[model samples]
Target chain A: MKAKVYVMLKEGVLDPQGAAVQHALGALGFDGVEGVRQGKVIELDLATGTTEATVREMCEKLLANTVIESYRIEM
Target chain B: MKAKVYVMLKEGVLDPQGAAVQHALGALGFDGVEGVRQGKVIELDLATGTTEATVREMCEKLLANTVIESYRIEM
Candidate 1:
């Protein structure tokens, strides 16, 4: 089985790295690029028959920094 | 316009960070968590009428480390 876990910063959190990317976009002459927020995705190849609940537990336990990020699991 | 860019390490690249996470997961008693590969997503809020081509340029120019990562855009 294959599972993909996407972890992203919660809205209202400051993303300095993302802000820098936004600034760079403007510098490169790309107009209307307002802001950027960055996050992570973790892809796993597991043995067959893994359940979605198990993947969610993985996200909660290790894949995401829940203090400032939210994660969604896709199989 | 809003663009979501997903950036990830190219396969065959060594991801020490991901390996560490996998190790930790096994340590925490999660079986079948075979491998972990990590990546990033950049979400942007732009003025209306931005083109996907323009966003790809943004990605090539600054948002991604193309030497080892690839990016896909979602509008």
Candidate 2:
């Protein structure tokens, strides 16, 4: 099975990396960009019969920092 | 309007970060994880009518390193 996890910063959390990218975009003349939020995608190639519950456990345990980030899983 | 860009390392590219995360998962007892690939997502809050072409230009110019990464845009 294949699973994908999308991890993103929580709302109201400061994202310095996203700010840096926003600044870079401005420098590169993409001023139309109002705001940018940067996150991550983790693609997992799993063994057959891997359960969604296990995948969710992976996110809660290691894939995401729940205090400052949120994660969504797709299988 | 909103746009999302998903940037990922091209196939055959070495991803040390992903490897490190994979190692960590094993340490944390997620042995079912066979392989992991990490990528980035950039979410853009744009002006009311930002063109897809412009967003693509942003990906080409700054959002992704085309030499090693490929990007998909959603609007």
Candidate 2 pairs with clashing backbones: none
Pick out the ten consecutive residues of candidate 1 chain B with the lowest summed lDDT: B33-42
Best by DockQ: 2
> TM-score per candidate, in order?
0.93, 0.97
Deviating ranges (above 4 Å) for candidate 1: none
Two-chain complex of model 1, DockQ on C-alpha atoms against the true structure: 0.85
TM-score of 2: 0.97
Which window of 10 residues has the lowest lDDT sum in candidate 2 chain A? Answer: A27-36
- Fnat of each prediction, in sequence: 0.96, 0.93
Question: For model 2, what is the alpha-carbon lDDT of residue B1?
Answer: 90
Which TM-score does chain B of candidate 1 obtain? 0.94
Give the per-residue lDDT of model 2 (tens digit) for A15-58. 89889998998998887778899999999989899999999999
lDDT tens digits, residue span A1-75, model 1: 789988888989899988888888888898897778888888898989999998988888878889998998889
Ten-residue region with minimum lDDT total, candidate 2 chain B: B25-34
